[model samples]
Target: MASWVILVGRISDVDHSATPHKIITNRDYLAHPALFRGQRPNVINLSNNYGYQSRGYYASLLASSRGHRVIPTVETMIDLSERKLYENALPELEQALNRCRKELGGEIPSRLTVFFGIAPSKASDRFARLLFDWFRAPALEVAIRDEKGWASIRKIGFLPLARMSEAEKERFVACLGTYTSREWRDSRTRTQARYSFATLVDPNEELPPSAISSLRHWARVAEKMGVEVEPITKKDLARLANYDALFIRETTAISNHTYRFARRAQQEGMPVIDDPLSMIRCTNKVYLNELMTLNKVPVPPTVMIAGPADLEIAAQTLGFPLVLKIPDSSFSRGVKKASSPAELKALATQWLADSDLLIAQKFLPTEYDWRIGVLGGEPLFSVHYLMAKKHWQIVNHERGGKPVEGGFKSFTLAGTPQHVIDVAVRAARCIGDGLYGVDLKETAEGVYVIEVNDNPNLDHGCEDAGEKDVVWQRLTQWFIDRLERQGR
Candidate 1:
């Protein structure tokens, strides 16, 4: 649970009777220390002016320095004040504006006010959400214009509460109540959990890293450990500042919203599982292959293919029956087996259209691939992912569009082979000391590393079968240890 406070330049700017939150003036907030000395509450700075050295600016600036999560951060205030500073965000905002324009029959109002990511009209609510994601503020005014047939963002700036009309003030109060309610999960009414944990999950994800049941199980377990666990989605990006730590349960990719969440959490100074750096390192196969080889981790002989011109060279290096993979591929979707020279040429040519670089590794025929779940640079659980029925890969995607995955056999850490555990930990360390599942192949020769995945599957019955409570306990402790180290 997180404490919250609303700061305004003038006490009369807002009707305190309309809201339950404590509203303080900028004078008291800046001069008084007893109000929020040690308690770092989520501060909502709705000051009237944000000019250089203004009280509004100082309120937010001081709140940040006091280790409090304040919206309309100094950086955001500065960025919104200058066009060049916020130009990088215009492309995405313009794209969102065009989408909203289409939703309104290719026409929309030239001006709109967004209060806590909620538009006055329901038609533009999505655009409001995107705007809030980019610029976190209490109120924002977006000016849209027609350029030919498309919509463009002409100017965007902060909207203070004092400028709102009576009806708009009522609506703004409702919006403020809605926004603060999401962040203010008081411990008195809730459980006695000392820390709030957010598990990022998507129920609509086709193949999520952790099942909803698994997330529920972890939440129940975490509650017993004095940690209030909440399942949040991608839409809860702005609310991330309220949680003490974040655990991503969705499959992570550098180009997706998962990376954005991770990066945002890192920026908020929160401990996040599968941090942005780990996602960047593990999402791309070419990078992983090079990193493993450079770290002296045992991996199959692999070659990189730039285009059709380099296909022959890759073939000569790895030979036939090689594994072909796009740079950013997961779940065996972009992975294929090139059994012959002609098939290699066809697959390489087709895959080259999507990515400039491809990875070709010697295909090691193994009955099962060993998956060692490593956390905090230590091996936690091990499983043998068997090959699909008469299929070369663990997941068979060629049979229609649906995927058929093979069975998994879980093993206690002590029951697993030491060599396998050693290789998995070493490979995972090459990436970072975060949660990971390292896939390896064992043969008569030796164990070879395949891939190090960032968000490993911790399904209810699959990964937790061997070490049920121990798994949850250690994971909870991981966050606790890091948070305590940071004096959270």
Candidate 2:
């Protein structure tokens, strides 16, 4: 039979003491060998100065009565003690346990469990430190039961539950228990044989209905491949440390919360699907242009114009029928097409009125573009994006009107030419590994890179001209296989 130890402390204490006197005073159970005449099991209750009123104290007393020994411990004084009291006290507790075994005239019980009574405080405060360090032990399990009397066990690994309110913490803990103990235990035997994995999705972006349909399709694909997909938002990101990877559908900027979440996950050595570096490289069109040009990848002739004086030189280099784009803008909101020098000047002046950084490039006359979905350095699917009827942009251009219906043509295999594949591969290599959509325009000369989007739209029913399931399956399997290899 195993021996058990319980420590009770107050939620609020005026003394501000830090010590294992709670465990130390419970020494009498093991000290008195006669108390355990048979293998009925040994139990020690270490509760004192808990500030529990009559009802709470009496309930604890009744629970302790089931144990063989009940001992009380208290701290008389503590004021500005600088030393790490808990770290120092742990060794003392170990020594005292050894002494108790010696007095018992035999080896101590093989199994020992300790339960703590936690109190709220600053995360760096002494009490928090004590709970964190102690609960980190492999043999220990920490739990908190709220005022509603619902108890839950804490999951292993670092989580932000310390910042949660008592009620929230209790609910989270309870959910953890239910998921791991019940839902997991009831899973298929095959799934149980493989490594466990979890993923999170952020819903910050106001995605088009088509995009939402695409996500659901992919979710189903992932489920079929045995990878669990959990949708989350910014509010849920704070509590999502247990997941192996995160897939964010939101557009990420350097100063945004999405970027912060990615940065933190990277610091923790957890692989993020669309990593922060990938976002930084793909989101900024200017940066993408520089990298693509340096690698000799095909890109539209482009020049940067910081002010009105540079616009003429840019127009001279790129010529008329060009596109002017503002830096750090997406969804084709800050873009305009100019057919002549006069129109170019007017557009640049209006655009530069709001911001300085502008890019001018010759506009390709292609009526449609290709959105190539690349995952883990390999191209998954290619979808042709046709412009809306009478609209130059693929997205709707009419004001206060419904989104324009556009045509799509998907290919399971790389239907793009070999030269285009080679160029896209080189460009994707420069962008590094992550999920991305590269917009390319195929010209008589070669495929020219238009823009790289960090959070590209995925439409399901919009394009099914080819083996769409094959592409979805490949992507799903890749995610599952990667997580399995990482031992998630």
CA lDDT, every model vs. true structure: 0.82, 0.52
TM-score of each: 0.63, 0.56
lDDT (tens digit, per residue) of candidate 2 on 137-251: 1112223222232222222222232334566445433433332232111111111123223343444345332255566777787777766666666666555566655666665
Candidate with maximal TM-score: 1
TM-score of 1: 0.63
Worst 10 residues of 2 by lDDT: 73-82
Q: What RMSD does model 2 have?
A: 21.7
Tens digits of lDDT, candidate 1, 1-488:
67778898889888889888789998678655356766879999989987644567656755654567888776567667766546656887888878877668778778889998899988788889888887788899888888788888889999888777788889899998888878532211111123698889889888898889888898889888999999999989867888888999988875567877776677567788988768756877766776676568999998877668878887898888899998677888899999999999999989877664678999899999999999999987888999999999999999997789999999888889999999999999888888999999999999999999998888877887787779888999999998887766
- Candidate 2's TM-score reads 0.56
> Which regions of candidate 1 deviate over 4 angstroms?
1-194
